[model samples]
Target chain A: MSTNDPYDFSARERDILRIVVGHIIPASAAYGLPGADDGAILADILRSAWREGRKLHEAAAEIDAASGGTFATIPTGEQATVLQRFREQHPGLARACEVVTARCYYRDDRVMRSIGMEVRPPFPLGFAVEPSELDLLEPVRQRGKIYRDAN
Target chain B: MVEVNEAVDVVIVGAGASAAAFAWSLAETGMRILCVEQGDWVKADSFPSVGRDWEERAATDFAISPNVRRRPEDYPVNDADSPIAVANFNGVGGGTMLYAAHFPRLHPSDFRVKTLDGVADDWPVDYATLEPFFALNDEKMGVSSLAGDPAYPPKPQVMPPIPMGRSGVTIGRAMNKLGWHWWPSDAAITTQTYAGRAPCINLGQCGSGCAQGAKASTDVTYWPEAMRERVEVRTHCRVSRVETDENNRATGVYYYDGDNIERFQPAEIVVMASNGVGTPRLLLNSASERFPNGLANSSGLVGKNLMLHPYAQVRGYFDEPMDGYRGPHICTWSMQFYETDPSRDFVRGYSYQFSRGHGPVTAAVNGMADGLIPWGEGHHEAFRSVFDHSAGMVSICEDLPEEINSVTLDPNLRDSNGIPAPKLTYRLSENTRRMLDHSVARGREILTAAGARHITSRSPLPYAGWHLMGTARMGTDPRRSVVNEWGRSHDVKNLFVIDGSVFVTSGGVNPTSTIQALALYFADQVKSRIYDLFD
Candidate 1:
């Protein structure tokens, strides 16, 4: 369901989530890495399972309450502080958010490219790896019949 | 609903690993063989690889545990009482559909556990007896590995080994530093094109049903050839129970068709290749007036002595990016600690398999579970640091047969067919716990020596019951075992059990190779003693 649904999330709750997830994975210009807010990852976060979506919205509301209804207006560092406090109070919810955020972010084309990987399914044309040198296994070959003999 | 009663020379239940091996072995005999499987043939194109959500699909459509997949063809299993959950696929290839295809032969010492270590009972047959079958199956399945592994006897032949990714190289260096015996893995995935199957493309999704047909799952390796040989495999036919005659001999089986219609298939010989748990559950459900306790369970040990390999894993984070997601999931392993040592508190031992880290989704989930990446700020940094920089290893430790840990019909739970669901009641013994702790500790040391910045070690995953064994053991003594050395039922002359359920002791390595070998060996026995089998 859309975040506009009253039972799911209000406009204020959506804004707060954007701020919270942004701090969780802030854009790193130095590393050229896209953060949680980039590539519509926040939208992906909002599209989680109903139970997890509710948890995320409730967690956002909790953050707003903790930040005195200014979670979105607060500075990024301050937002991180409030989110960390919420995490301490609700570790499970925090983990849920982290899992959703990481899962979505890594699948993003921009994120995958930044990490030097093709943004595609690993099939049809799977990646290649160089075969190992046989000499590398010389030690194991020298140690003969490691298994005990049957009596 | 349509019903049919047909008689065949041989009726094999469950078209899984053992069943495929047995059917292929007996195909040359020109006997009328019929295999009834509950699940449909899984097409290669339907594999997860073609989808963008391949990894996610693995947790859903291609999940190893039937309880999670909930496919129409799968039966539910009640595993709440057990610490080690049973994870098996129900399709034509069975568990091989989702197996990692790591095919390691059981150690010779694994056969004589009682004779050598005074623990579990010795296998009725020794490793030497099954070596040729192992070679045959390996050749047919296109096993890939280096030639000179000191851990094994001289094998017939093998394809070139798969690439050892950076993770494997790191683990190999650590093993060398420790002077431990490590070798390239013996895998069922083809390294070069063989038997029309393409070489592995290194998708790193071997557990998600290989789409390229590179993985040697029985659906591709045996079922096709067996079908060509005129062995009839009836899909979507779930065998409910093995029917017995008034003389207490197994005659055939009662099954539910795709339309949920009941039907009977009569046969001169009935083979149970439905795995450790499924085999026992079927036998227990087939209780009749002639064999009240269960079919071929005159010793009252049909569902007793369950053995699930107690597994544990350790992940090491290296400073450099290992590109740990680039190759086969399991490409290297070490048997340095495979042999039992008096110094160790445990009786049997374990083998260590080196793994490149999981795919992106699994890595993300695992990272959160390990608390390596916390929720708030710097989460991205933590995730990035661990993403491609980790190498891992799994220790498949041997679990002894204990009568207390068993598969029984759940009193309340039932499957789609209204048959009682199999309930697994299991707990780690003190001995197993000690062994797990030891393996984890050893794993940590290896990672530490390998220049790991950090390491995460834990007990076995609940879903690590991939190697199910020893539910209905085989032995010479009819008073103590359900089946004879030839896998024939001791009480019923024509009944046979050709699966891991006939294992006397759970070996430290994966049981698929041994399971196929034993099935082929028993099929040979059936051919040699055709006259004796009927009498």
Candidate 2:
């Protein structure tokens, strides 16, 4: 995390996002899916957050401002309420951040494998698809000669 | 620096689909052939599918839209006046480099639109005349499909069709439930390792230039064979304009080479296979003292009558995984609403091309656009609902030729090579709008029948103008068309256009198959008339 990004996305702001990520996509212990704020996933999110540059920083500022500047020091139990309110008020920005988060989240090999995706490029060794059921075309075949015979 | 390089018997411009086919066919006559291409060879291994961020690369580096991708070779198109943006690739394989390879032939009635429907002009050539070439192209390009569809006259598929995976069978059953017609779409993809290329291993994203060499882009299919026949394709040479003599003959072309130096290449005959937009752009740019308006533009219709088949997309999220992405974005399609009906709102109809859903990133992004996949607590569930659980179709609606829709030289914009850019002026006809609505409704019906819970649709899709055509039409009369029946330019006898630009009418199906068939047909005509080709 940059200590001096032009938009004030400093180390202090990074800590706030870590809290924000945990609340947004909390750990799904039942599914074994990590929270968005998990060390590795959060790193990817932060890198991608940098890609979305100022908007994310602005989102951070609004969340901080809305939380009476106590978003960082606030109890973990109360962060979700503040974040939820921020999301409801600024649905578009929150979603933009979520998309960026999800994009980075899904691209992780571990996350991809968890989703049953073969954590590799789809070339040289391609995926397997179920066999085609040409029998389904029986109905269409029965109704045959659908083209206009302009000839 | 601007001196003539060398003289060749025949010179072709743009090394795309038609150019490759035409060059291969004409090279049989023991004549020297040279092709000048604006871009270099795009190697199959360099395709994005070989990388982890393949989907992201597709959205950026290999984007189909030239204005968005803006690669070095791509020329900017001013499409501010048109609803649909121009999509093309500028490399050796041209648009085929990024094409989905859907490869469907135009229907027979598409030829005589005016005669059958009393709308649009009739093509001088009939489907029967080009059927043999179509079959021939299928063999050379290694098309794969099961041939028993009752949609049209019977034709044999070169190989077995790609498997109609989960999404296809799901949609097929839906169509069958409604007693609608659906069949495996004819794809220009090798399923049996034909012509030394490997068969597709179910590698999903064919758009990222099929690194497996399964997709039959001209670079893999025709260019190698054409090269073997000594048809030299000079890449990175952007032909600025065709030089015409005082006698109104196309003597040669002036081009910028790889070093960005200008040079003239002399030829006895010049053929233009530079697609709908590129061909018209070049023709209008080739305006000289003799032909003030444009060469081969005695009818003043060189860049007019632009026909971009308007496309409509509809998506349906299903309950189960639609299997892995297979075939050319689609393996099967419904022709339930193809061909015209006297009571219908439109004259020409559309093809229901059932499509497979996108990769993960694309699915997430599309879902977000629909506002179903929000960023909050339900993000993962919404993503899961869409990712592999969606099936869709696009209605390739036939757009009738209109003189008002045209491509003209942009007075302001120019390419890196300093050639003036092409400006597009187009509008969706009221007839087409009604047709789009009807098709979208049908798309909804089929998807809903297939047990789709959530559906989203858009008509006259803004970025689906991949099939550019009809700017320079073919007709018997010189005053009515830019090229004659055989694709010979009326004003300049030695000049010929063997691209989609010479399409008389935009057919409901994909035009690559027809484009290649026309190119081969034009080459055959040229070979037969080489002794007396020019007036």
Docking tier of model 1: it is medium
| Model 1 CA lDDT for position B103 | 92
Which residue runs of candidate 1 sit more than 4 Å off their true CA positions? A1-39, A42-97
* TM-scores of the models, in the order given: 0.93, 0.92
Q: Is the docking of candidate 2 incorrect, acceptable, medium or high quality?
A: acceptable
lDDT of 2 by residue, B361-383 (tens): 77766777788776446767767
Clashing pairs for model 1 are none
lDDT of 1 by residue, B143-238 (tens): 998887888877855798888878888889889899998888999999888999999998888998898899999999999999999999999999
List candidate 2 segments past 4 Å from native. A1-30, A34-102, B1-3, B324-327
